[model samples]
Target: MASRGFIELLRLADMARARKNGRQGGQESDWQGIVFEIGGQRLVAPMGEVSEVLTMPEYTSMPLVQPWMLGIANIRGRLLPLTDLSQFLHVPSRLSQMSQRKVIVIDHDSVFSGILVDQVLGIEHFNRSQYRSEAIDSKSPFAPYNHGKFFKDEQDWFVFMPSLLAQDSRYIDAAI
Candidate 1:
């Protein structure tokens, strides 16, 4: 009878450890991302792609460029082109207070651009298995660069790939 009780206690302890690990993302297959609002759509940028988030910096408006191309801003001695992602995506702005807007900077490879977003909701972790690559909304302007979507909190978080945006001809050619 003592051996039986000891075995039961061991099982309970194992269960507790497993529960703790699951809560901490072990065996959770977690997918972490930087969540931000762009063009009124909530998006999750791949954690590795986003270099930094910053306040909307003052930039020098460039001449004869697409209206979405806000211009260039000097950041730490590096010139970063500021792009209004909502406008560039041809989506109406969420109309948030300008003070609340932020720039999601991407410095992948040689592509260094500051993407303006309505809001930065910080990092979030979702179950990797819940990410659906085929369920991305086709109507979203970001759909082209988006790779997948995560259903969280009853809403969809589209995965935005700014590295792909850097290679897009429409995004690269900023002439009026």
Candidate 2:
């Protein structure tokens, strides 16, 4: 009876360990994103893509550049190129004052760019199952850069693929 009880105890411990591991694995599979607004549209990007968020900074205007190229701003002694994300995405530009603008800095690979946005909504956590790989309208300007979308609070949060945006020729071509 003593040996049987010891075996039962070991089995219980094993079960408990398995349950703990399962919960941790489930949590690891969850997706997280930072929500932000651009051109009055709600969008979300993977949190890992965003390096920093800051208020609009004074930037020097560049000559012979597209309207979407806002110019370069000195960020902590680093010259960061600022892009009007709304204009680049072919959306209506928000007419908010400079003080109300927000910049989302993306530092990936050799590219470092600050995306001007309307506001930073905050971080949102969602499960992998919550994502839907639906087709975006071909005519939509965001169609090429959209990864997927998630729904929350009766609103759809479109996932904007920053990496793709970084690689796009249009984004790379700052000079006219």
Candidate 3:
């Protein structure tokens, strides 16, 4: 009986060791984000800031709202206001790409809404080591909500913070 108990303890120790190793390896890819195309630019939203991504859904147009506001959509029994990111940023979008728009839902703290983007390029796992925080161009509209950027695959993926966007008065005040 003592020998069997010893074996069980050894197995437990091995499992613990494996788990620790696994966690340590994951540190290299500490940051993950959902990459999407918006306004002819590739942007990435932090994984933690986005709840889910869904295809365009039917929504009722609301009168007396900003043109950027695509109105409210019924998402899983919850009303989610969909906003056109391109319109809000005043960025020009390719007309051909407009048909592939996807909704990126963000639900946190005081914000629960979906922002429409040109395309959802899937989740990207990036190492924090590749991050860059240099100041963005002064005239860039996205500069306000972009925290920094992650350089990967020979491209700069701006880390978009929907939380920051949510805090913007221009974004929240939708009434025309």
TM-score of each: 0.79, 0.79, 0.81
Compute the lDDT for candidate 1: 0.78
lDDT of 1 by residue, 89-128 (tens): 8888886565678888888777889899998776666786
TM-score of 3: 0.81
lDDT of 3 by residue, 46-92 (tens): 87787777778899999999999989988768899999988999997
Please, what is the whole-model Cα lDDT of each candidate in the order they appear?
A: 0.78, 0.77, 0.79
Which runs in model 2 stand beyond 4 Å of their true positions?
1-29
Q: Write the per-residue lDDT of candidate 2 for residues 31-87, one digit (tens) a residue.
A: 767678877777888877877777788999999999999899997788999998888
Cα error, residue 51 of model 2, in Å, equals: 0.5
Candidate 1, superposed: residue stretches over 4 Å from native: 1-29
User: Candidate 3 — worst ten consecutive residues by lDDT sum?
Assistant: 1-10
The pairs that clash in candidate 2 are none
* lDDT for position 134 in model 3: 62
- The positional error of residue 41 in candidate 1, measured at the CA in angstroms, is 1.1
The candidate, 1 or 3, that scores higher on lDDT is 3
RMSD of each: 12.2, 13.2, 10.9
